[model samples]
Target: MSPIEALDFVGVALFAATGALAASRKQLDVIGFLFLAAVTGIGGGTARDLMLGVPVFWVERPAHVLACAATAVLVYFTAHLLESRYRLLLWLDAMALAAYGVFGAYKGLAVTGSATVAVVMGVLTGTLGGIIRDVVAREPSVLLRQEIYVAAAALGAATFLLLDRAGLPLWVTAGGGFAAALILRGGTIRYG
Candidate 1:
């Protein structure tokens, strides 16, 4: 698979895992986990695609749905090890945020050839899943946090764009983008 598609898969899986954790926190059953996973996995991409006037990916390719559900089931079985580890969820979300941010920026640039639009799509893909997760979980939104979130996404997106413009390989630009995001969010986790 291409780097972009692989990153998208990783982002979706990470978000789905976090969703499963949220479901466990809510004392939800397997079905609830599945629902949350689906919502968290597809919500941002769905919105992004709809806005871009493209086909919603999961609808066109059902494998994405299966991946989300399968991730939920795996997390459900392993919830015991993850209980009381919301920090892990945040870290996982951070990774998801980074991966999706890169993928989204690349996609946006591919379609529109606009760096500005790419940044917006990157941030949207990065954080929208967590927003939906919080909304569905009835928890306070991450947008309310003072620590880095959207900023990290934007930084990553911009970094990716810059690196891409420099004619770096896709893997290098994407890895740099991911590192940018993780470093920013890591500081937040450490300092906050």
Candidate 2:
């Protein structure tokens, strides 16, 4: 697969895992976990597609849905194992945010050829899943927090745009964007 496609897959899996973990915390059944995972994995992309007037990626490719379902099943059976590690879920969620932010921004830029709109799309893609998950799970959404989550997404998108303008390869820009967001998010988790 292409680098961008691979990154998208990874981001989907990460988000699926976060959703599964959240469902586990809420004592959801397998079906509920799968539902949440699917929503979390594709909700942002679906929203972006709708806004951009493009076909939703997951709808075009059923593999994305399959992958999310697989992740939810895996998490459902291994919930106890995962729960034993207190911070595992949190870190995974952060990774999902970073990866999705990068991929979403890249997709937006690809579609609109505008850095500002791409950044907005990036933030939406990174945080919207969590917003949906929290609303469904009855928890306070992360976006409502004072933490630097949205700032990190914006920074990642801006970095990606700068690298793309500097003639860097797309893969390099994507990796750098994901890493920048990850570091910023990690710092936030550490300090805040």
Candidate 3:
């Protein structure tokens, strides 16, 4: 798979893990884990694809759904081994946000060729899944938290666009965007 596609799959898996972690915290059953994981993995991308008039990604590629289901099962069995499931969830989310932000922006740019829409798509792709997860888990939404979540996603998308416009290689552009997002989100988790 291309780097962008790899990032998209990775984002799905990580976000699904976060959903499963939330389910574990709530003492939900395995089915609950699967439900949250599936939604958290694909919700944002599904919306993005629909808005772009593209085939919904998971619908087109069942592997994405498999990734979510596998991640949910893994986390369901393994979450208790972590010292702080909450902290791990935050970190996984940060990583997934970075991946999704970059990947989403790339998709938007590929489909629409509009940098403005690309950034918005990136933000939606990164944040929407987590928002759904939080709401279903009865956790405080990241938007309500005084953290650097959405801004990180925007910055990542913008960074990718800027680097792409500069004619940088795809690796550099994707890396820059992912790093920019992870650093900002990690800073918030570390400092606040």
List RMSD in Å for every model shown.
Answer: 1.1, 1.3, 0.8
TM-scores for all candidates: the values are: 0.96, 0.95, 0.98
Model 2: per-residue Cα lDDT over 1-192, one tens digit each:
877787789889988988898888888899999999999888988998899889999889999999999999999999887535336666887888888888889999999998889999999988888888889888777777745778887878888888999999988999899899989988878787
lDDT values of the candidates?
0.89, 0.86, 0.92
Whose lDDT is higher: candidate 2's or candidate 3's?
3
TM-score of 2: 0.95
- Looking at candidate 3, the ten consecutive residues that score lowest on lDDT are 139-148
What TM-score number comes out for model 1?
0.96
lDDT of 1 at 146: 45
Candidate 3: misplaced stretches above 4 Å?
none
Q: lDDT rank, highest first? A: 3, 1, 2
Ranking by TM-score: 3, 1, 2
Candidate 1, 24-54: lDDT as tens digits: 8888999999999999998888888887778
lDDT tens readout by residue for model 3, 1-192 = 777777888899999998999999999999999999999999889989999999998888898999899999999889889899999999999999999999999999999999999999999999999999999889889778944799999999999999999999998999999999999999999987
Off by over 4 Å in 2: 83-86
Query: What is residue 160's positional error in candidate 2, in angstroms?
Result: 0.5
Model 3 CA lDDT for position 172: 92
Q: How many clashing pairs per prediction, in order?
A: 0, 0, 0
Which of candidates 1 and 2 is the stronger one according to lDDT? 1
Alpha-carbon lDDT of model 1: 0.89
